[model samples]
Target: MSDSSQLPYRPCAGVMLVNQAGKVFVGQRIDSTLDAWQMPQGGIDDGEDAETAALREIGEETGIDPSLVRIVARARHELFYDLPSDLIGKVWKGRYRGQRQHWFLARFTGTDDDVKIDTDHPEFRAWKWAEPSELPAMIVPFKRKLYEDVIAEFAPWLESIA
Candidate 1:
């Protein structure tokens, strides 16, 4: 087996999309049988800036148009997470150890009707608006700490708009 330590982390962008009521968006992944839920995120394309990648991910994953959301705050630094050992060779074609992500906080300006998860390629089987504090518990275990850190960095903005 290839040593996971020798692998690089994937470059990714993530978004914590909150609604006017302060509830954040979490989606149950279509690919996972587990009850894992996560915010919109995906690998950043080459030459795409993190913010642009973040907006694209939201539209790709949730089918929510960029015009329906407003970017609020960005995490001060990238957050890193390692995939579980068992998954290291199975995911991302075994090219990545995990992910190093740039995360953004966006506010959903449109009503609930605007969210349509059945996009050209849907990532989530189901989606919901969740309380910000519930993020860590909702995510897959490997990404829980990363979610917590995102909430911490965006806490002030989350509160101000609440």
Candidate 2:
């Protein structure tokens, strides 16, 4: 696949939340028949800020409130994948190409019991704590390298956050 730098890519953010136990949160998608799993993420909305989008996406996907998480670090990753002409969102219409995601690392201040897995539009059915290094395989192939890159850049901060 071509890098988003080579293709039109929309900016996005994926948030990784960790607990005191040193485990990172991984969400198992509920709707996908294939049962894909990934961190909470979403496209940046105009008039809305990136950090706000990250926090909003985390709450929307995991049902955890934004107040419960503390921002640690952020890393940018870009991937180029074809979005069929008809599938691009209105923001990317006319010349839509692909997406570029900037992922953030956060540490949850609340306990495990505070996590709420069900939401009005849940993207996750189940969530569990996993090692940060093992997260790449759980994401989509086109996003795997980006995930790795984000984790690598924030490994030290993640360790301390845990």
Candidate 3:
């Protein structure tokens, strides 16, 4: 296998949208059959700031407007994860080997009614609120490490409200 450096990592932003109860939102992807769930995330568009991209991703994936969330915290640095070897050349038009993501923690001020998963370009088919501690097990195996890191980085903020 070629070293990961041979392919660039996708620049992406992830949002950990938490409600008043402090549970994070997770979605079942429309493109996968494994029943894996994930927080809102997407590519960072050219010329867009990470925070703005994160908010945009939330809106695009969850149909929740940016106005509904209150920023809680942001990771001090981007986190990297390599795609599985079989996925290295199949996903993202083979442009990226994996994702290097900047994750944001945001509190959902709006009620559950505000979340509409059926967006114009829906990435998820179903969704729910789950304990942040359950994230690692809920995500796809390939993304577990990234989810674990997300929990670690966002733990204090989650605890503050719990």
Q: Which has the greatest lDDT? A: 1
Model 3 lDDT, full chain set:
0.91
Q: Flag clash pairs in model 1.
A: none
lDDT of 2 by residue, 6-71 (tens): 446776777888899888888887866654578788888988877899999988888888889999
Q: For model 3, what is the alpha-carbon lDDT of residue 158? A: 91
lDDT of 1 at 56: 94
Q: What's the count of clashing pairs in each model shown?
A: 0, 0, 0
lDDT (0-100) at residue 162 of candidate 3? 37
lDDT, candidate 2, equals: 0.76
Q: What's the CA error at residue 113 for candidate 3, in Å? A: 0.6
Residues 76-161 of candidate 3: C-alpha lDDT, one tens digit per residue: 89998888888877889888889999999998999889999999999999999999999999998999999999999988889775
lDDT of each: 0.93, 0.76, 0.91
Model 2 worst lDDT run, 10 consecutive residues: 77-86
For candidate 1, write residues 87-129 as lDDT tens digits: 9989999999999999999989999899999999889999999
Best-to-worst order by lDDT is 1, 3, 2
TM-score preference between candidates 2 and 3, better one: 3
TM-score of each: 0.98, 0.81, 0.96
